[model samples]
Target chain A: MMAARRGRSAGLIRLALYGIGLVPAVVSFVLGATNRLGADPVNTFERTLGLWALRFLILSLCITPLRDLTGVNLVRYRRAVGLLAFWYALFHLSAYVALDQGFDLHTLLADVTTRPFIILGMVAFTILSALAATSNGWAIRRLGRRWKALHRWVYAAAICAAIHFILSFKVIRVETLLYGLVVAALLAFRVYRAAPRRAKAPPV
Target chain B: AVDLAAQPGPLSGEGLKPTPLRDVTHYNNFYEFGLEKTDPAERSGDFHPRPWTVRVEGMVAKPRTYDIDALLGRKLEERIYRMRCVEAWSMVIPWIGFALRDLLAEVEPLGSAKYVAFESVVRPSEMPGQGGVLPVLDWPYVEGLRLDEAMHPLTILAVGLYGQTLPNQNGAPVRLVVPWKYGFKGIKSIVRIRLTDRQPRTSWNVRAPDEYGFYANVNPAVDHPRWSQASERPIGAGGGFFGASRQLTLPFNGYGEQVAGLYAGMDLRRDF
Candidate 1:
């Protein structure tokens, strides 16, 4: 009976995550309609979605800590959250290229090559794509332990994203600094937690 | 866009279309308020602009504090000009104000005055950005122009926008409007006008001298170290939808006829 209840709760949680993930697009549309996105609505929409994408990525990373520290595992929804993050990032890139750059491939190519922050963003998204593609049960079963090891790239993706965010803005704001600190702490926590267990296992 | 049909031919010939009023007023980069575009519009409610006084000092014969009303009482003309930002965005604004030359005339600048410096008002309590959130930039924004740039007919100390008094976020009471240069060259909420022999240290130049220079003229040849300046994303061109409308940037922002002669002998690529 307890197992059945756990399964039901996990399904409900997944539904809730999907609902939450889709809220930003609705909010952006309403904002656009009411002329509330401020001057440069495209920029506002793009920035808002990009921020939401980062938040979701951070939240997805937080789930593992929540499980290990408090035994409140939300592991089943991680893939869904990760995929949402990827979709948001894709849309953010679309906004930049279509709305900001006006589909100028030359300009977009120039930006990706020349702008260090843009290159970092592109790298983070590329890593996320790899993780998302291999997230299925079939891929996991086929790859065996390799799947678990490769998924660790998320941490690298998170760090790259944090650095990109910091470098993109003109000023290193307090909020941006706080975000970088949080990413650092999260990575440090993962390392500290893993070292003792890896030492005990000692190559099997 | 400014209604060209409504205005006389002489005014129409000189005028470029002003960006949509909402876009022109709402989208801002006044870092004194905050970095976000909407921050100034939202956070400037508490800023007190009335009874504002501007102290004219330095190499001037008559250094005095001119009230907002006193400045408004003088003969003013409407100037419609292009404003380009250092961030590669451009806007055409119809600003209402008198030429800076008129203000300089009042002060009677001394022979030694080679540059004119403008200082913005600073109230940390009101200006959220100045509250030490990002101390990267020096507070009380400062910008300077050569004596000739200061005296140019196109250079105006603006007081209003779109036929109305400027909103606080739009630099209420007074601000500098130099059509030929990047937007940062135009300091907002000006409180002091000083004449000096040496070039004043502008806010952005002090923060990142390599990226921002003293005379930040709009030149397509010289790009910002971080981004391309050859083209600009004109805001409000999308017509309530998202449009990029990247247009080729003009030398001196298409005001070469009036201001290009000032830099005739100087290399624009280096000056930029």
Candidate 2:
């Protein structure tokens, strides 16, 4: 009974966090669609959504640390946060395709190929899409240990996304540099934690 | 003196005021101060405008210096033009200024002079963005034009906009306004002018030669490395559907007739 109650509470908490995460993305989209943003509204909207997507992805990555540090055991929220991140990322990609490119597949393909930053972003989104698709319980049960291995691709996706952002700006700003540093730290933390545990266990 | 209120045709229309221009100009990407679009406006407000002087030298029969006050005393004209940014945004502005040709004639360029190079005022203390971590272009922004382009009637030595003295954020005292090229071609807060036989390196081109070429012409066919120049969104048009629906950017910002001849012989893709 106690275990079941704890599971229910965790599920509710996960739902609430996912709802909270959507606020900025939805507001930015509605505001962008309504023409409430400043000059160069489409770019502004696209950038806002893209940044939120990255932020949520980073936050979802940080959940393990937060759980370990606070002893709150918030792992249940990871999937929800990850999914929300993917949703925002989908919108961000769609905005560029629909508004900027006017659904011109040729131009979009040409841009993705010519621009290194755009290519990086596309690669990250592709990996993220794969992860999001196989996130269901049936897939997880079927794949078993492979599920964990596949999800590790998130780390690569995060790095690619960060590089995508860094190269986008003409001159790299402090805000962007700071975000890059945080992403680097999170990645470094995961590697540090994983390596030591594996060494101590004498090769799994 | 340039009477902005008396400009001909569409510019004289009631909505064609300098406020929007001022807003856009004041808020800009003067990379010497910093690369961010808004950095120049924020950091440049405290710039001291008094005691300014423009030194005209190099390849000139008579090298001379003119004080800001005396420079403003020359014949001024109001030109309403569409200022297009290479970043794919644009604004229509009524500029109050005298012809740059008139200013060049004052110095009297030598027969061999082929290009006109302009420099902006550089003061790091007042411009905080100058202390940024990134290695942007050197201080004192520099812009240049071919001799023919420099002498073009559309190129103006702008001292004011909207019938008012230039606000600090808008490159106060004096700046250059070339209607046909991208906004960066018009160097701001200019303090130096030099006539050279060789083509001069512009600020943007110096920083990223691959991205920003010396010509810097506004050609819709030639796109920026990361984005397309095919369209632009007007300022204060609000975001989302409202802006997406109304903003229809025109090639050469609808000034092709006035300035297209300058690039007739050259392939814009190579030059741009």
Best by DockQ: 2
lDDT of candidate 2 at residue B111, scale 0 to 100: 96
lDDT, candidate 1, A51-148, per-residue tens: 77787788888888899999997888889999888888887888778767788887778778987788888998899889889988899999999998
> After aligning candidate 2 to the native by TM-score, how far in Å is the CA of A186 from where it should be?
2.4
Output DockQ, candidate 1: 0.38
- Candidate 1, after superposition: displacement of residue B205 in Å? 1.2
Residues B233-253 of candidate 2: C-alpha lDDT, one tens digit per residue: 555544454454424456566
CAPRI docking class of candidate 2: medium
lDDT of 1 by residue, B1-272 (tens): 11111122132225366788888877888887888877888888888888799998999999988998887776666777788998888888878888889889988999999999899998989888788645867878999999999998788888887877778898887999998899999999999999999999899898888778888989887877667788887877654334446788998888788788898898766667
Docking verdict class for candidate 1: acceptable
Clashing pairs in 1: none
How do all models score by TM-score? 0.89, 0.89
Please state every model's RMSD to the true fold in angstroms: 4.4, 3.9
lDDT comparing candidate 2 with the true structure: 0.78
Q: What lDDT is reached at residue A124 by model 1? A: 88
